[model samples]
Target: MRKLRELFRLRFEAKLTTRSIAASLGIGNGTVCDYLGRARVAKLTWPLPAELDDDAALTALLFPEDAKAQAERPEPDWARVHAELKKKGVTKLLLWQEYLEAVPGGYQYSRFCERYGRWLATSSVTLRQEHRAGEKCFVDFSGDGVRVVDAVTGEVRVAKLFVAVLGASNLTYVEPVFSEDVATWVGCHVRAFEYFGGVSEVVVPDNLKAGVTRAHRYEPDLNPTYADLARHYGFAILPARPRRC
Candidate 1:
């Protein structure tokens, strides 16, 4: 369409008849007439803009310019934050808070997160790697069932067992429990940490009823006992999403 219009314009400027222009451009005579009609309606003159030498540039100039640029946040000192996160216990939220304090008129929470995510795209980091010794402890429920037996009454009960796997060593600890209640859930973590000999820097768990009271995709609510256990161990509890199950 654009090429036909340009060809008609050039031929008409050279004072050729509509039929002649159509023949030269290998288009229908009616197409040449339509182009001439459109040019007349648009009030396009023979002489075009000096800057618009080509058809592409002329077409661009016909349309209105885009809107002005929007305000944006400044880039953060990613190197410092990256180093800090590598240290024992550093969180993105904590770093963001500190950034706000240091730069009074800095980026908002959402923008800060957006910028951090962009940085992560080009980051030379491993998504999944062997954790250093005593680095992380991952806890979750076992898919298979475990049986709990009573010696005196000769009673047997099948229940779900909570399992904890160390990130570095792959050393796992399992405990059979009657229910997935809050008390049992919190108690299992305590025993698991003790069994590991020392508390880990981070604790990862699924969004189970016992651990998380409200399971939100963006922000989750950790049960009081769950938070308390984290404080006791000087670690953090990052709940995994339900989709992970």
Candidate 2:
């Protein structure tokens, strides 16, 4: 603000060249030019109008992007957007066009998605984890399925992905299995432990059907085979509480 006022003073009141003003103010010549140019375009002069010496007023007069965008753009109804995104044939690009129609100069498509992702991150539920070195390994299935294509038959089948990660170092193991049944689930755990070359103190898993036979608020039932695997591996099994928020 002081620099802005000094720039106008040097140009209009003292009749100094922008380069001279930059040298005197220890600012860039280009910076002085930009500030004075904005002042000129705003029709502001040295000593500025008494009503608008506050920094905010000066900033709005000089750089209006944030204020103008906020005032002119209507905020999206994010909850509605989140719900609508779950429906078929709906996408972020489609939603962004709808948003722009309502507010002609709202955020562009990329910015709209970026902002929505940030909001979802804040509003969504997450299990807070505290991990210690070589203490635990967490495992889960990817919600999306990957397609496996046959080499010559042109056959495609959806594959369920099994993922495991060391809680501390985040060493990851990824494998695609035909199904997330008990056999495949146990096999994946064996492979994951072999890949890490050691077992942690505990294995943490979400309460998927393959691991937890019966879902309960408390005293959930672990599959008998999965329990045997834990017993053989000398590690404890702790299933995550379902529907956590």
- Please give each candidate's TM-score: 0.45, 0.63
lDDT, candidate 1, 82-105, per-residue tens = 788886668888999999888778
The regions of model 1 sitting more than 4 angstroms off are 1-128
> In each prediction, how many residue pairs overlap at the backbone (N, C-alpha, C within less than 3 A)?
0, 0
Regions of model 2 farther than 4 Å from truth: 1-65, 79-94, 113-128
**Deviation (Å) of 175 in candidate 2:** 0.3
